[model samples]
Target: MTGRKALSRALDLSLWKGALTTAGSREAADAVTERAVPNEPTVRLTAVRRLYEVSTRMGAGRSLAETLQAVVDGVVTGLGFGIAVLNLRHPDGKFEVIAVAGSPEAREALLGTVSAADIFDGEFKIADEWGRLRFVPHERLPEGEVVGWVPDVPVSADPSAWHPLDALFAPLHSPDGELVGMLSVDLPEDQRRPGPIHRELLEIFATQAGLAIDKARLTDQLLAEKVRLEASETTFRLVFEGAGNGMATLAFDGPEAGRVLRVNDAFCRITGYPHDRLIGSRLLDYLTDGDAGRTRRELQELATGTGPYRFERTFRRADGQDIWLGGTAVIVAQGKDQPRILLIQIDDVTARKDAERELQHHAAHDPLTGLANRRLLQHRFEAALQRSRQRGRRGVLLFSDLNHFKQVNDRYGHEAGDNALREIADRLLTAVRHGDTVARLGGDEFVILAEEIDGTDLDALIRRVEESIGRPLAGIDVPVTASIGTAVVSPYSADLDELLRTADQAMYEAKHRDR
Candidate 1:
């Protein structure tokens, strides 16, 4: 009896193992079939296949609107809903109808009239008072209405018969927790309560639909960013290549003399050299002999990170032309390597410097007479006085005023007066020694500073100035004369302001005497 019992137990164990194997195989097959046919009998297997194909095609679409319309069509066809509406919220906190399908009248009624408050707060009401069965919001229903729309229903029951006409609302949410839109399905009372399986399927579809919407939005955002970046890069390249100023980058390896690393097209155009010829060439090779040692030291100091250097230096261009460059050098490091002494920026300021020198000339000289203006004369006068005082010598200040300048201007116009001034300046310049300073102190007034002179020599200088001014002006046939007053100051009594005042008084006395 014991042997038979043991054998029976072993056979039962073998039967159990076989049963487990068969059950596992059946489960795997069922999984494959479910994947193959996602929809149930309500939706034919072929319909499910077509739905997937359409979804795949729509997924490859570029426009978000097209993709969404395809999704809405697939869901409506697959689920057999009477009315389907896809509403999307905009950035302005308003809901917009994105996709709709069903009766034409119903679609037109729901298009732009729906709002967030209408769907979430307001209740759907079904009434028999109207000739045709229609669903309206509860607020629109008259007072004392007995029958209202279905409020809540079980997930497992057949809602089609119990609540023949009802409304369904499902919120579409994105993965990042943004409320994208609301999906609403309206059906008759007979199709009110959806079954457990149907509800589960709807939930799955909703999740997948949200993911598709997010993917479409992300694709659009990426495309826009790509366009913006490309535009920015193009703008930078154009400016770098077409700018009128010269720019160059030098690499600092060991400070033996930094070499040119990169140069823009403007640099090549300005220097008359091609980019290939300048790269890897030492910057010191272009410097003139007078500035070579200083330039070398400056580049070395930049390599040591002392300070930024900026100065004017003459460089030999490729065509053997000497040009002035206003250069600036600094130290920079792109990576963890040692700091690169970047002799980075240089501007071909030859034209600007030349213009600046011309401007300086205009500032120091009078336009009408081409003589030194008062500002320049004052600067020279102070320097001469200081020199005379240091050397214990005497100097004379002669203040001269034209005798009849206004009468000449009134008779012959300002142009002839200007010619007279020019002629007088030329004659006075010739009469004075090269060391003397002559200046125009505005309308019809002039001054001269004669330094390192004795009393007799001073008198002779004054006589020469008077003779030169009395001579006939070239363009004007009239003879112009100037009344001159001389003031002499030795180191003992040389006060600039007092001497000027005394010279003015003496000038008035000379004019009175000439009159």
Candidate 2:
């Protein structure tokens, strides 16, 4: 072999022996160590072997800190370096000593370099052949940068003098093969600089170290996620058990439609069903037939994406009492195997519904006669006009006034007068069709809004009204007559006010003609 080739061969063999010592025995380590140069081969071999061993223990190391410490231990011990530091780039854009291995003095010196100011914004070069180690002083590094421990002066040398130490660095990469930080080893002033073998050994060690560290980081993230999932389960359980409002989950498309999957305690309390009784039961079983049927249709429509999730339904409680329930449903899944689960929330609204019904009754009906009042008459009048314009349906308005009814109140008491008015309201109701509206517009003035009528039906309607109102006043033993005037509501855009005015005018003319 040529001289250069022989030397390179020797170097390769030496490294192999160092790597092979663990791969083999002590004789293998000495086989390469005795060649031409003196080196800590056993040390580099141990570090490389340490890297291999540590790399194997990846699944056990659950934190990056533990993994980095293992790497630095291999670095300082395997290379006989004065100091070893594992500096990692943090999220805050700073490099800090996350792990260190060295003598007490060396470790303290390396730790002194750790501060908020130690940002990893520096530059250096790695030779392509000896591609791992880069030695640089603090001054050559970026601002606020610190690397390597202070060099130890020899005891035989000058005591007052201090010597500078240089850092030997290797890149630590992430799982994605991106350089995330550096693994730095250094020597005291009396120790020699790192040579080719030192650089090569460190480079190899770093490759494995980076893999171990990144794997450990990923393991830590997984562990953290597991902890979060357990905590979330606990919190959700607490909320579901202690909530005040009724809540339940329903399964769609089961043999028992809307079968209750799960129900909170509040839901059981609201529905007056025990936990065991509710679980296997259908939700519609507890609701009125009409409302339950409507809800089932709406839920089917909901699956077709054609309805709102929120609706009002009346439920039949366990005691057969009815209660209004405001409810909302949300589908949580899709597909047949995983039938859509509905999360339902319910609130009792029976009292509110009752109050609303009472208010509507008072607004639409007269207190004395229980007939529709003038306000309701106006509403129906406007609605009839709209229906006539839209559907080509005809209507009739019979304006009837009680003639000389004031004399009954003048002679008899007002109580008897009220009785007379009530009797007239009864007669009016009996005369009109079931769909018609007979409204008292104060005093003895009453109007009938008969819908779905035509010119042919008007005469029959007028006859019914005139015959009913002309009956005797039973309490007073006297006859009461009424002037019943009619106006036809054509299936055209007829104004309500104009029609009422014409009917009123015709009523007065009828009164004069009757007198």
Superposed by TM-score, candidate 2 places the C-alpha of residue 328 at a distance from the truth, in angstroms, of 4.3
Candidate 2 lDDT over residue span 1-515, tens digit each: 01100101111122232343553655553343345233444433444454334333422345777667767766655555545677775666556667766554334534424444233223344222234445554334345533332232221132322123234567676534456667766552223445444554465456556655655665552112211101121111111333334667677666755888677777888878888998888888887789888988888877766212566788888887888887556454332243456667666768889999989988998988999987888898888888888888778888888877888888887899899999889988898888899998888888899987876688888888888878887677556778877777867636767777888999999989877
Q: Given candidate 1, what's the lDDT at residue 70?
A: 55
| Candidate 2 lDDT trough over 10 residues, lowest sum | 1-10
After best superposition, candidate 1 residue 15: deviation in angstroms? Answer: 57
Over the full model, what C-alpha lDDT does candidate 1 score relative to the true structure? 0.58
User: For every model in order, what is the number of clashing pairs?
Assistant: 11, 0
- Per-residue lDDT tens digits of candidate 1, residues 1-515? 01101101111122123433454665553344345333434333333343334344444445677656755665556554444667776666667777765445434544554354344433333422111112333234446633322223222233233232244555565544466766665442123344433343344345445545765766641112111101121111111232234556576666533777667676888778899998888877888877889977766665554333456888899989988887444443322333343534456778877898889989999988888887788788788878877998888888889987787898899988888888888989999998888888889888888888887887788889899888777656565788888787677655656777788889999889877
In terms of lDDT, model 2 sits at 0.61
Model 1 RMSD vs true structure = 25.8
RMSD of each: 25.8, 23.7
TM-score of each: 0.46, 0.47
